[model samples]
Target: MDVSRTRVLQLIARPDFPEPYERLAGGSVWLAEDVERWITEHQPWKADQEAEEEP
Candidate 1:
């Protein structure tokens, strides 16, 4: 199975995206459920962060 580096990077960078379990091992952190929980718990904070980044 071949995966593009760009696509893999995108998944790692996005907070709302769900990553595969295998990816979590071998120092590739961030679980899918954790991301979901973070989004749920910090929706306002996440929005604020995005808003602050925008012009």
Candidate 2:
């Protein structure tokens, strides 16, 4: 679950992005649920590696 803050902000700012959940702050839209789903679906390998590394 490692992500750069700048990249997260960029994804939140993209106009054509279809994100399921959103929040408004300082007149900007932020996508939270979409990022969660993206991390779960796209980073399966990372999760597996992390699980293996854990006790």
Candidate 3:
């Protein structure tokens, strides 16, 4: 979650990224679960310990 706004915008621009769940006055919002799945697929190194932490 330490990602920068520019990086997030870049991700959002990708065609494969999940669609925004809502479009508020300020910006768009996507579900965390969807984002996490996308991140896991794109970033395996970061998820090395994720399986152990899951319930």
Candidate 4:
């Protein structure tokens, strides 16, 4: 979650990325659990990100 808004937008635009769980008044929303699962399966950098999160 240290990524920029632009990076997040890029991920959201990916064809294989998970869709938003809901459409809100201002924008879309996705469940954290779903996003995490998708990241674990598809993002190559996920392991590195997890390593960075650990103390």
The residue-by-residue lDDT of candidate 2 on 1-55, one tens digit each, is 4669898677556665555443466454536666545546766686577667888
lDDT of each model, Cα atoms only? 0.62, 0.61, 0.84, 0.88
Model 4: CA > 4 A from native: 51-55
The candidate maximizing TM-score is: 4
Estimate the TM-score of every prediction: 0.29, 0.34, 0.75, 0.77
lDDT of 4 by residue, 24-45 (tens): 9999999988888888889859
Per-residue CA lDDT of model 1 for 8-49, tens digit only, reads 686567765555456444666667576656655656576566
Candidate 1 TM-score over all chains jointly: 0.29
Instruction: Give the range of the ten consecutive residues with the poorest summed lDDT in model 2.
Output: 21-30
Off by over 4 Å in 3: 49-55
RMSD in angstroms between candidate 1 and the native structure over all alpha carbons: 9.7
Task: Please report the TM-score between candidate 4 and the true structure.
Answer: 0.77
Higher-lDDT candidate of 2 and 4: 4
Candidates in order: C-alpha RMSD to true structure = 9.7, 4.4, 2.7, 1.8
lDDT of 3 by residue, 1-55 (tens): 3779899889899999999999999899899899888878987666766766668
Which residue pairs collide, candidate 1? none
Best by lDDT: 4
